[model samples]
Target: MPANESTNSPLDTLWRVHAILWMVVAGEGLAVVLALATETSSDRLTYFGRLSVAIQWVMLLTLVAIYALRKPLSRIRPQGVAYVALCLLLINTWVTAGIAWLLMRDVGPMPAGGWQALVLRLTGIVLAVGLLGLAAFQNHWRARQAAVQAKQAQLESLHSRIRPHFLFNTLNTGVALVRRRPEEVERLLLDLADLFRAALAGPRQISLEDELALARRYLEIEALRFGDRLSVRWELPGVMPAVTVPALSIQPLVENAIRHGVEQLPAGGEVEIAVSTTPGTVVVRITNPLPHPGSHSHPGHRVGLNASQVRIEALTDGRGSVQTQVAGGRYIATVRLPVGT
Candidate 1:
């Protein structure tokens, strides 16, 4: 990985704030213990307590500045989260120490003036904050490294699941149809090939034009197998090229409509496919006629429904969801995904 990638994630900034606070607290505790052991002066406890609180206030003020700005830097470098933290460290440490020294102006190395005391205070602040930044950046790098590793594992899992489960069943259906009525088999097989190509392709997103083409092919194959038993309708856009969607997202729902919806109802039913978009999201709804609970046939049990849910969830980074319910004797599964990642 490039060094700059490590310079970007926010998790490191979180840890740096936390670690600095803990070290300052621990250092105060150690100073108190030493004073007691060495018989340095009971009055010194007051100085340690005041310095610790002042340093902590500086850290807290820096955090408040971070939250208030919220844009990483006020302007110029929007991506400079690390640089902001470093600036906060230097300023907070220097300012907090300067204030603490003012309160105890008569004590320590600089008995001359407040400005002289301010310089001495900066020394500890600089050392402590500098060291803390180093530790935090290491953690940021490791966490991102781990994220890359986990993503590889997930892609491999998707690779295994990518084999078309429905294809085996689909081809079998085509073979049976060919044995009984061979004329439509060639047309059906071509459609099947196109559908498989869509599944195997690796683009993260696809144009709706391609999705409609693929969905149409899959629908044609079902139409061949089911004959007059399947009724399909599309509420697609007039300008098809204006739309795009996550690859294969629409078809699996369509497959589920066939497996659990159309194929389940022997007397036949209507399957409706539609897509629309809102300000920051895309909506796809698949609705099909419902059968009496026990009277319905499940295509390969409930595997299709279960698998589609898992696959969509994985692809969306948890921003998308699928919900299934029966309303007015119609089974509806609507999927919602954020418009852009």
Candidate 2:
């Protein structure tokens, strides 16, 4: 998904160039027999062979160009890629075979039923295979690159939604303490800083223990503002998976619960977060009261929570997911993470 990756890797391109053009040379040798069999003028057939040899070089340049033009190549449709590959295959074979026959003229006729004729036959076959292989693989790699790019784009869009959602909720909470006691501003500022730090950490991968520590830090900050109104129930047991997950994965769910589910209610409510490993999977669940009967939401009430869920699925390639349900005036969100990931 990175810019440099999409573009041709210079090292790889160099290797392919060195490696693949030999297929053309090998194909040209096969053209020798075709040249001997054809009735066309020797000069004309030789010219055609030379042209085919020239075309192989053009193909090498084209492949290099394809690598250099990384973005557009991935955007190419599957069928279009197939068409291109087929065209290249045919063209290289036609051109190289003709050139081989022409070049072989000076070398003398193939000895009938002898080792010389056998060598020419084998060389032709090898060239055909090599050219076909290159075309097939080129299309496959392009398709793979396109898929990866699309997935990365989806992940970025999901992560982009997080900053605004968290900021809105945190600032709203800060405004409450401001009216009653402005002196709490400094302490609140520190909490806000910690919250943002957890939010903006690098990379989508981190250890599970680190994610939990971050979630706890975030909850501690929120607890200062909410006082006893917000309570935490951590149900993590012995031996947690050390696998990586999106950074600060659990905090947003708890934060969302505190902001929209519990903070609005007069009695407040408890936020229960539990994590445990089962076989090859690790599960984390957070539960909070609905604040009132018949509680429901659309988007804005839980954007931060949704962002985290989207990110987890993206990072895990659907190996992880979040399940949510409202039961008995309580909203519950469960996250399933693959331990093997």
Candidate 3:
């Protein structure tokens, strides 16, 4: 199975805002618990305030160290990353505890025990907390890996569904042309072969220009079948953006326009494809005239549109979308992709 292109490691969570906030809360909770256990009722409040300062300092410093080395940590296995994080926490805790002892040894009421005993207790607490954090990290990593695997499996299934449907439809079109225009059958087969090559390439990204070229080839094959009945209008930008889209993303929408829109009309209608770009996104729209309500409508499972939508969303981490709506008596299928994807 191919790995996700944009998946982040579990260790990466350390730098997230919410995760950091949670860690701070956990540290404060630990300080409160320790204070209640080791201090008298009258002094527990002061002990908690002091312990929170030391604990929070240790946690924040360890987090900083981990973030600074995040690139190297990412290169290591998850187990190794967890071990390193635990080690950092322990080291920070010991160092912070030592500093607190040196600074405040004579300032206030000690926790029944002397500085050495306090150091021992702090080390024990840190080791226990570190182990618990390690376990949590392992669980999170396993869960994330499982989710990625499930998503990849779904993408593969969608791809499988799309390939057979595309192949059958193209083959039927070839069959229709084979009996009438034998010479054109060769060109149609060539195009079909190219499309199949892309469809079978598995989950991957292709340049926007390459995707458009593939869509154009598919349209060419359909043109041979529709002849004068099928007319296409293309509106494209002068300079295409440097971006990648999932394979076969655009072609399926074109196929839907022809099958559901143009093919239903007696005097086949025009299919308009327009591509435009903004500062951060690229949009493609396919429009075809709808047949009258009483006229014969093509019966379709809408597999292509649904598959395209799913594939785009999966590949783009939900940043891209496929949408369809009816306006001005025309059915439009729109695809939006984020730039720098």
Candidate 4:
């Protein structure tokens, strides 16, 4: 599975703003229901005020406990996590109800069944709500997991299609070199083997530095075919941050630069690869000159660029992007990845 496919526990979901809002709404609804069920017309307002405090206290304390233990709970099975959350809810309900009972005893007379009965009634309500919430969370989680799996399967399929195209391109480079540059053919084949190995390794992430190295090897092989017509300018940061990107992500874009851009121009052009970083993002840009109008440039299908875009977006959980544009007679492809992902 891709690293980004890992699902968060239900406890994590509870910490989200929308989830918290829903909890507050549900708690208010429960308070209203309890007020109507147990209190007389005259005492309903007073009973609601006290019940609201108790319910909110129970909900808040239970949420806090879950938040504090979220990391540990994430390691356990989903069913076990649900069970633990319900246990915490029950415990908090009893503790909050006991405190409310003692504090309100001197304030007024007890209801028909007294504090003990109130506690029991509160426990039943807590259990029912807790079970219902858990069931809803489990269903939501399963749906999310299924969607992630489907996206991953689609990403893997795209990756598999990309590999053959890369392999065939590199082999063609090697075949060209074998006729006139027999000595260089051995080195070309070795580089081709390394590049293919990485491509064939299946869906996984590679360090930014490692991915750049692979792109360099690919360019080296292409250089053997294009000769002096192909020149590369690399602008790298002084220190490369520790970042991981989908494997083969950068290489394909570089290949596109050579095939569709430099290879079409008569006096070939420079391929500029620039890597820069912001506080929370790493950006890579590849720029190559566009062929002149009426030049023998074949229409590009953009298969590699599209595949790279999908893989990057999927791997980064939509936090990263691959974009391309044409400006100043140059075809520019840019990739942005979120830092510390």
Q: Candidate 3: list runs displaced more than 4 Å.
A: 1-3, 12-56, 98-115, 182-186, 277-281
Could you give candidate 2's per-residue lDDT for residues 221-240 as a string of tens digits?
57767787888888987877
Ranking by lDDT: 4, 3, 2, 1
Ranking by TM-score: 4, 3, 1, 2
Candidate 3's residue-wise lDDT over 244-273, tens digit each?
888887888999899888888878989999
Which numbered prediction scores highest in TM-score against the true structure? 4
TM per candidate comes to 0.62, 0.57, 0.81, 0.85
Candidate 3, residue 108: lDDT: 65
**What are the root-mean-square deviations of the candidates from the true structure over C-alphas?**
7.9, 11.4, 3.4, 3.1
What does candidate 2 score on TM? Answer: 0.57
**Which 10 successive residues of model 3 have the least lDDT summed?**
1-10
TM-score: model 3 vs. ground truth: 0.81
**lDDT minimum window of 10 residues, candidate 2:** 1-10
Q: Model 1 off-target regions past 4 Å?
A: 1-148, 240-246, 299-315
Estimate the lDDT of model 1: 0.65
lDDT of 4 by residue, 1-341 (tens): 27364344455557668879998988889989988887464577877987788888988998999889988888898878888989998999889877876787888777668878877877888888888988987897799878777877877777888889888899888889998799887788788888988988888898999999999999999999999999999999999878888899899999999989999987888999999999899999999999899988886777788888988887776789999999998999999999975
Clashes of each: 0, 3, 0, 0
**Ten-residue segment with the worst summed lDDT in candidate 4?**
1-10
